[model samples]
Target: MEEFFNELFDYNFFCNKQLIEACSDLKEVPKESMRLFSHILNAHQIWNARINGLESEFGAWDEHPLKTWEEIHYENQRNTFEIITNTDDYETRIDYQNIEGRLFTNTIQDMLFHIINHSTHHRAQILADFRANGLEPVSLDYVFYKR
Candidate 1:
């Protein structure tokens, strides 16, 4: 299971790097693209914080400046790898509060997978926004990363 999760983290990092690079190339990134990617990075940080029993350094919708994105992203991925390597109980339930301050509990494994699924969902939306803006979308599909 750890092996599976390590692969997912690797894939997420790879795809995120690709998307960020493409976004950086734009003379002006679309507002929605910026918002979505910011949300993606913020959410990843929040999840890792939740698992580690710490306060999130970012909010769900916070807009991190594009200039600081890759650096922030690297920190998030590094923390995620640390979490992945150190976690001993994936099935243990984690208690956390949502951005709305609603309390809930979910298994660590569920949260791990949710992070990947959540990022992929938003990344798709960002791609759609890029296409709508007449920009080329970077290929981020998992199979493409596997090769």
Candidate 2:
């Protein structure tokens, strides 16, 4: 199970890095794309903090500068790797409060999967933004990354 998640995170990291690199080259990234990517990065950090039982430093909808995206992303992925390595039980229920302070619980594995799935969903939106802006969209399909 750990190996499975490790591979997934590796793929996640690759896909995100590819998109960031592409966005970095553009003169002006679309506002919608920036918002979506920021949300993606912030959400990943938030989930990692939840798993670690710490307060999140980032809000879900904060607008982070594009210049700082890669650094923030690396830190998030590193923290997630640490969490995965240290976690002994994938099924252990984690009790956490959302940004709205609503209490909830989920297994470690489920939350980890959510991070990747959520990112993929938003990255698709970002790709659409790229097309709308007359920019080439990055290929971020999991199969593309796999091959």
Candidate 3:
């Protein structure tokens, strides 16, 4: 299970880095893309903090400058890897409050997978925004990343 989650996270990291590089090279990244990508980074950090029983410094919709994306992303990836490494049971339940202050409980496995799924969901939105803004979207399919 650890191996599987680690591979998924590695793939997630790759796709995010690709998107960051693509946006960084643009003369001006689209407004919506910037907002969506920043949300992506923020959400990942928030999830990691939740799993570690720590307070998150970012809000759900907080916008970060492009220059800070990579640093935040690296930290998120490192923290997730640490979580996966230290976890003895993927099925261990975690109780956390949402940004809405609502209490919820989920297994470590579910939360880890949610991070990847949530990022993919938002990345697709950002890619669509890129296309609408006349910018070419990079391919981020998992199959392509594996090859």
RMSD of each: 0.7, 0.7, 0.5
The deviation in Å at residue 130 for candidate 1 is 0.4
Per-residue CA lDDT of model 3 for 1-147, tens digit only, reads: 999999999999999999999998999999999999999999999999999999999999999999999999999999999999999999999999999999999999999999999999999999999999888899999999999
Residue 99 of model 1: what lDDT?
Answer: 90
Off by over 4 Å in 1: none
Candidate 1 lDDT for residue 45:
96
Query: How much RMSD separates candidate 1 from the native structure?
Result: 0.7
> By how many angstroms RMSD does model 3 differ from the true structure?
0.5
Among all windows of 10 consecutive residues in model 1, the one with the lowest summed lDDT is 138-147
Worst 10 contiguous positions by lDDT, candidate 3: 129-138
Badly placed stretches (over 4 Å) of model 3 are: none
- lDDT digits (tens) for residues 1-147 of candidate 2: 889999999999998999899989988889999999999999999999999999999999998999999999999999999998998999999999999999999999999999999999999999999999999899888789878
How badly does each model clash, as a count of residue pairs? 0, 0, 0
Worst 10 residues of 2 by lDDT: 138-147
Clashing pairs in 3: none
Best by TM-score: 3
User: Model 1 clash tally?
Assistant: 0
